[model samples]
Target chain A: MSVIYQRVALIGLGHIASSMFWGMKASGLADEVTGYARSAETRETAREIGLCDRVCDSAADAVEGADLVVLCVPVGAMGAVARDIAPHLKPGATISDVGSVKRAVIEAVEPHLPESVHFVPAHPLAGTEQSGPASGFAELFHNRWCLLTPARADATEVAKLRRFWKGLGSKVDEMDADRHDLVLAVTSHAPHLIAYTMVGVADDLQRVTENEVIQFSATGFRDFTRIAASDPTMWRDVFLSNKDATLEILGRFTEELFALQRAIRQGDGDHLHDYFTRTRAIRRGIIEAGQDTDAPNFGRGAHSTGRAE
Target chain B: MSVIYQRVALIGLGHIASSMFWGMKASGLADEVTGYARSAETRETAREIGLCDRVCDSAADAVEGADLVVLCVPVGAMGAVARDIAPHLKPGATISDVGSVKRAVIEAVEPHLPESVHFVPAHPLAGTEQSGPASGFAELFHNRWCLLTPARADATEVAKLRRFWKGLGSKVDEMDADRHDLVLAVTSHAPHLIAYTMVGVADDLQRVTENEVIQFSATGFRDFTRIAASDPTMWRDVFLSNKDATLEILGRFTEELFALQRAIRQGDGDHLHDYFTRTRAIRRGIIEAGQDTDAPNFGRGAHSTGRAE
Candidate 1:
């Protein structure tokens, strides 16, 4: 884990940024790490937690001498942060982002970046429901996928950035920005919206008291809550920015849901059973791929013992 | 921890029955436990694993001389299991069930039970995605809720059954059968149907390769897969048996989902943020009530060590 970047600037002090800071320190991936956040309180918390070697008061100041600058803000705010920091970015610096949506972020931030700097929009496909400057650890990116969408970038710059993420213990892969949005819409965005809708439905049901829903949630609804409780602003922007893809996936979801509902109404047990059986293969595939564990109940007990909040 | 029943008969050696046997044995709540499954292979597994003191060949044989006969079969099969065991139960014996649906189970089972026996329908608000005798453990019911819906049973019989569940490390409460069905429809049945439909949609998406979906499932779809991978036979029966309540919840879910989808389409950030904030409160309630841990990532790391899959 030698230094991959002599100086790295993290332009948003949130979960991804703070985790990148700790991970870089843990792996010696950066000689010096500087961080900045728009909120005074977040910057103060970063200072208190020793989140970075230099907690810069301004985003421009943070990227002044850095060879790498990463925008770690929400999708909707990435443009403003990019514009604010563009003027101060060093020549030959590789500017990336950790936003969930790639196409929208690239469109928003690309115009503001200097032609001299290499802009490679990236997203690390790892996170928890928790956010903020304090809710990060060095292992957040370990063995996780980091999708890098380098738009006609220099090969040497792309490889260096790949090595930096690899140093943080991630498997780096390249994808087109449009394809990334569509894939994420299927994998993350639509699923989250569906979870949120389910939770909201349970809350709106008057017959089943909220107390009962929470008390008996272990059966299945608890998982929906975990996904629905994710950072609101980040998810809001994701759905808004990736509207067409999210809506398309969601439309398919509704159509499929209606089909299943008809099967239930028609008492088609075979249809339900066959559908359920087929989905189990995908779960097995996920486990075999090492993306998810196959312990019963998602292995909550092992992780929630002494360290759970 | 005293013996609540001299002999307890488990009429199906599946997850619930085996867990009950182990929990009862762990707490010394039953002098002897007898188990029987329709499948001879399951009986052999039970005997090999010492899941019960005696693994009987027939439900009638298992229920003989037992003061407590608990039907642990699917809801659709409860009536047949009840009729098979009724003639073999002791005069003052108590008959119970662990079916997820209550009203249909009561309708199916109550007529089959002898007048001398007490019919108490119960649903344990606990389970893992895994099934079968091998998946059972002594701590599966620890601190979980087990709802009992007694139909005009003697107070002594109901009290005894409650104590028996308490001995198994579950918090027991009584509710009307119809109300139990409604509450479960909101909490478990509907959420499961939604999870199943989402997983099925993910599988059916031709553009998104199955490998890609499996690899990127850590985002949100993985949780849906874990739930959708639950015992197909049991879930199919649940949906069919509890059709009315489940359909009701699904209707409400569709309505709420449409509202959220509209908000996303209209670029209504305020609507999305408000709804997300409200759902966060319910998650907090679940954590405070000890139904779920507040750990990030739903504590997947805790239970998903080397033992995953």
Candidate 2:
């Protein structure tokens, strides 16, 4: 429960930033938190909701005299936000970001940051279909993995930042920016794209009828619908920023899908059985590795559990 | 709580059958429920666990003198089961099935049923990734949808069967057999196939490493793993039985996926944004239509409010 930082500046008041603000306050990890958002309405909502100790008028104002400045914007906006606040960042301050794609973010933000500040690119692989400041809660980070890709960061500064995330109740791991993006593309981006695609297909079906889709969705399509409900702006930026890795994963996905389609068309029951059986084992491995909870956990709310949907 | 039938027969003692056994018994909808499984081990388990009042050695024996007979096997096994029980079915008995694909099931089963029996093809859109007798619970069907495709049958029998499902806490809808298959292919089969395919893709990635797939799965691929963990035999039969509809939906899915891929590869942010936005609205529509619960329900174990992971 020890305070990790005296003053923390949150450069965006979206789901991640608001969750971090509440988490830091609830854990007593930060003595003071200042928040800023691109829209006046969001900044006002952040202040009114008491998500931060103070809601600043601008990103520069939020970072002034702060010990830590964390950018939590869409990936496409990282460079502009970084440049906008660079002049106001305190000397020797540690700066970080919670963006889904890391390599692009590091490339976008590092050059704009002054050498006096420590830049650590991080991604907390935790979210819900809901977005914005109103959707965040204090326990969103509990027991979730936070990947940190610190480029040439000082040892002491890196340790301090790691402790900051750990204090927020996250298990931390370190990886290179490019590797992080690649892993995420396989794990998150490709799956999300698939969900979007399947839901779109269902929505576009003129013959099936929408009522039937809604009534009988409990089978499997409902899962895709849940995933497809994620914030549009954030995901749009993710696909834009991590184009190479996302495209690579999508290619592999489409190839496997085509093979499965052929198997189905040929009535190759054994091939379908083998593929399904192998994938079942992978799910068991995920459960055994403590990466996901078992099937019964599908009714729990976001803040109450660390398991991903 | 009135008993709708004096005796009910369950032809397969798997997840759905076992769940129905418990659900009917718990709701006091049937005075006597009998069960039969092809394997002696399963029959013994049913007896030991008291999954049914009587455990018959054969499907024909189970159906004899029963007012209702429920086929709960894989779709591929339904025709044979119907033929095996046809001679033993009580005169004027109501026969129904719980299969994923309706049109193929009716085709497979109707030929073998006696003209005196009323055939109602049903699909309860409720199940977990787990299967077998041990995986079922009494509350598994609560708040779920049950779709029934009754042929030109006795109205009294259809109403009685609908009441039986209602007694188990399911809202019932009736549709034509061919239309039911097409609707489910879009809403259920295709989504499951996509899930299986993506999980397979992740499993095939040699460079990423299994541990990485497990550790970083929170990104998106983990959701598909859960769905892919479903019973392989049941799913294989689903695709095999409903081949035409599934292939048709899969074709549409692939075309849409390719379009999205081209957009991403071309770095067309607007295209990604518009598509993602449209999909998000569909998800919202699903939530509003009451097909999905809005609560983030992915981590809570059964019988506990705590999130599982």
TM-score of each: 0.97, 0.97
Estimate, for each residue in B1-309, the C-alpha lDDT of model 1 and write its tens digit: 788999999998888888899899899999999989999999999989889999989888899999999999988899888877778889999999899999999988888888888888888887887788998888778888899999799899999999999998889988998888888888788988888888888888888888888776655777778788788899899999999999999999899989988999999999999998888888778878887665554424536421111
lDDT of 2 by residue, B1-309 (tens): 999999999999988898898899899999999999999999988888889999999888899999999999999999999999999999989999999888888999999988889998889988878788876777777777888999787788899999999998888888888888898888888899899998988889987988899877883677778789888999999999899999999999999999988988888889988888888887777767765556543443342121100
Which pairs of residues collide in model 2? A187-B220, A188-B219, A188-B220, A297-B298, A297-B300, A298-B297, A299-B297, A300-B297, B299-B308
Docking quality level of the chain pair in candidate 1: medium
How much is B209 displaced in model 1, in angstroms?
A: 0.6
Q: How big is the positional error of residue A25 in model 1, measured in Å on the Cα after superposition?
A: 1.4
What is the model-wide C-alpha lDDT for candidate 1? 0.85
Candidates in order, interface RMSD in Å: 3.6, 3.7
